[model samples]
Target: MGDTANNTENAPKKSFFKGVKSEFNKIIWPDKQTLAKQSAAVVAISVALGVVIAIVDIGVVYGIEQILKIG
Candidate 1:
């Protein structure tokens, strides 16, 4: 009875790792050229977004300063 319980517990762990390995083998990884293009696109978008945020911040600060001066 004890041996049967131990085998049942270990059976799931062994099958789970086997399933993980099978899934990894099925993956189609991206090529280096595709990876580089995607990385560059992400970086360019990040920089463009940063510049837009900075411009908006400058405009807000200037507007607030003008309002304070009017008071």
Candidate 2:
């Protein structure tokens, strides 16, 4: 009776870990070429977004300075 209770307590955690491992094994990860292409796209998009944000910031600063008449 005591052993049965212990088994119930531990079995769920063990099964969960086993299921995770099985899922990881079954995953078909992207190939190197695909990964590289995706990474490059991400970097390009990030750079483009940064440039846009920078332009907006510069415009705002210039406008604020002009309004205040302060360099």
Best by TM-score: 1
Question: Model 1, range 1-71, lDDT digits (tens) per residue?
Answer: 79999887777577789999999999999999999999999999999999999999999999999999999
Candidate RMSDs in Å, in order, are 3.9, 4.2
The list of candidate 2 runs beyond 4 A from truth reads 1-12
The alpha-carbon lDDT assigned to residue 67 of candidate 1 equals 100
Q: Put down candidate 2 lDDT per residue, 1-71, tens digits, no spaces.
A: 79999888876677789999999999999999999999999999999999999999999999998989963
The lowest-lDDT stretch of 10 consecutive residues in candidate 2 is: 6-15
Q: Give the TM-score of candidate 1.
A: 0.79
- Model 1, poorest ten-residue lDDT window? 7-16
